[model samples]
Target: MHRVIISGIGAEIPEPVITNEELVASFNSWVDTENARRADTGEPLLQKSDSDFIVHASGVKSRHVIEREGILDPTRMSPRIPARPDDALSLEAEFGIASARKALAHAGVDGSDIDLVICSASHHQRPYPAIAIEMQEALGTKGAGFDMGLGCSSAAAALHVAVNLVRAGAHKRVLVSTPEIITGHLNFRDRQTHFIFGDASVAMVVEGLAQGEKRPGRFEVLDTRTWTQMSNNIRTNLGYYTRTAQEDPYMINLEGNLIKQVGNKVFKEVTVAGQKFIVEFLAEHGLTPGGIRRFWLHQANARMNAMILKLSFGHDVDHDRAPMVLE
Candidate 1:
C-alpha cells in the first residue's frame, strides 16, 4: 500500500460579520412582537435573548455569514442569498473553488494535477448535479467527482476517504473541499442554536508520496477510522421530502424541520463519546493522550470540548492543549 500525505490546506471565510449584540437585538425585537401577539390569546410570552447569555452558553462572540441583509432583519431571521441562474456556477462551488485554488497553489500543483474531487459538508444546497462535479469543471480537473456528507464530521470523513483512496492506489491526488454555508440554514430565532454556526469553506489536497520525497510541513496519514451510532440529539429535518410529506404539499413548514437540537443532551452524550473514542483510538496505536502534542477537535461548544479533553487527560486542559476556532 502506498503512503499518503496532506499536501496543502486552504480556507475561505465569509466577509460579513455578525456580533452577538446585534443578533440579540434583532431576536429581542422579534420576541417582543411575538409576545405582544401572544398576550391577547393568554399564551406564554417568549423570553428575550441576551447577548451575555449567548456568550456564557457558547464561546462564540461573533460569526461570519455569506449575507447579513435578511439575517439581521427581525421579520426574516435567515440569510437572504440570491439564487444564481443555472448557467452560472453555484454559490457553494464558487466558494469551494476559491479555497481549492489556494490549496492547489499551496501544493505547487495545478487543477489539472488533481485526479479526484470530493465536495463534502454539513449541508448541501441541492441534491442533484453534485457540487463536486461543478467544482471539477470550474477548476479544469479530471477523473471522478462526487459529494458526501456526515454532518459536522464531513470534512474529516472526506479527508479519510481521500487518504484511503490514495493509499489503495484508486487515486493518486484528491481534492477534498468542504463548503459550509451553515448560516443560510441556521434558525437565527432559536435561542439555543442561533449563535452556533458560521459560514466558511476549506480545502485540502491529499496525494500519494513518492520514494524519498520531502515536503516540509506536510501531514503524513498514518491511519484513519470512523465510528457512528444512531442518535437524534443533533439533527435537521429539512429535506426534499419535507415539502412533499406535508398535508398541504405546496405549503412550507419551517418549524420543527430546520435545525433543532437537544443541546444539553448533545453536550453530555458527546462529551462521554468523544473521550471514549479518543482514548480507544490512541490505545489501539500503542499511544496515550500525553503522547500527542496537540489536539484540533471539532469546534462546536467550547465547554463540551474542554470537558471531553479533561476527561481524556484526567485534568483540566488549557487553550494550548486544545485550540478552538468557534468565533
Candidate 2:
C-alpha cells in the first residue's frame, strides 16, 4: 500500500453573515409575532449555563450565497429556491466547482493529472446524475468522479477512500472537495445550534506513495480511525432543517442534546480511543502522533470541542484558537 500524505488544503468561504435577529424577524412576519413566539418558546433544552453552548452551535451565524449581499429575509431568499432538488444541486455545484478549481491551483496540480475526484458534503440532495459528475465537469477531471455521503464525517471518510483508491492502483493523484452549504438546510430559528456552523468549502489534494510524487514540505497522515458509533443512527433531531419535513420552510434542525446528552458516555470511549487506534494503526505502519508536528481531532464549533479538548489534551493544550472550526 502506498503511504499517503495531504499535499495541499484550500477552502472558500462565501461572504455572508445572516444573524439571528434577521431570521427571527422573517419568522415573525411569515407566521405572525404571537404565533411564532409561542412556537419557539419552551423549556430551554440547551445550555445550562452560557458556557455549555457551543460557540457556533447552529452551524451558522452567517453563510455565503450568491444574492446574499445584505440582511436577508429567511422566507424570501432571492433567485427563488427551485422546486426541484437538482436545481439546488447545480446551485451548490457552482460553489463546489469554484472551490475545487481553487484547490487544484493551491495544490499546484494540473487538473489533467488528477486521477480521481471525490466531492462530499453534508447538505443538499439531487435527483439525477451524481453530484460528483457535476464537480468532475467543473474541475475537468478526466480520471473519475464520484460523490460520497457520510454526514459530517464525509471529509475524513473521503480521505480514507481516496487513499485506498491509490493503493488499489485505481488513481495516483486524488482531489477531494467538501463544500457544505448548510444555509438552505439549516434551521436558524433554533438559537442553540444556530451559532455553531458556517458554510464553507474545504478541498484537498492527495497523492499515491510514489517516489517522484512528493510535495517539498507536506504533513503526512500518520494515523486515522473512526468511532463508527459516533455516527448518529436515526436523525430525530436536526439543525440542518427546521419545521417538519412538510413545513414549507424546509430548514435544518439542530438538536443540541445530540451532543450534550451523550457527552459523558462518549467521552469514556474517546478517552483511550486516540491512544488505542493511534497505537495500533501506527504499530502496523510504524508511526505515532508524537512523531507528527501536530494532531487534530476533526471537531467543529466550540463547546463540545472544549469538552473534548479538555478530555483529550487537558489543560496543557490550549485549543482556544485552533483551526477546529475549519474542520
Give per-residue CA lDDT, model 2, range 1-327, as digits (tens): 777777777878777555545544554454453354555885323312122233244222334544342225545433234554544447667677777777778777877878788888875556347677777776677777888867667888888888777766778889888888655554444433333445678888887657567566776664455556553422325434435553565543343423222333444554456446545665677665444345565555344445544444444445444445432
lDDT of 1 by residue, 1-327 (tens): 888899998999889999989999999998889889999999988888887787777788898889987999999988888889999999999999989999999898999999999999999989879999999999999998999999999999999999999999999899999999998888887888888888999999999998788778999988998998888998899988898888998898998888888888998898999999999999999999999989999886788888899999999988787898875
What C-alpha lDDT, on a 0 to 100 scale, does residue 223 get in candidate 1?
A: 94
Runs of candidate 1 exceeding 4 Å displacement: none
In order, the Cα lDDT scores of the candidates are 0.91, 0.59
TM-score of each model, paired residue for residue: 0.98, 0.70
TM-score of 2: 0.70
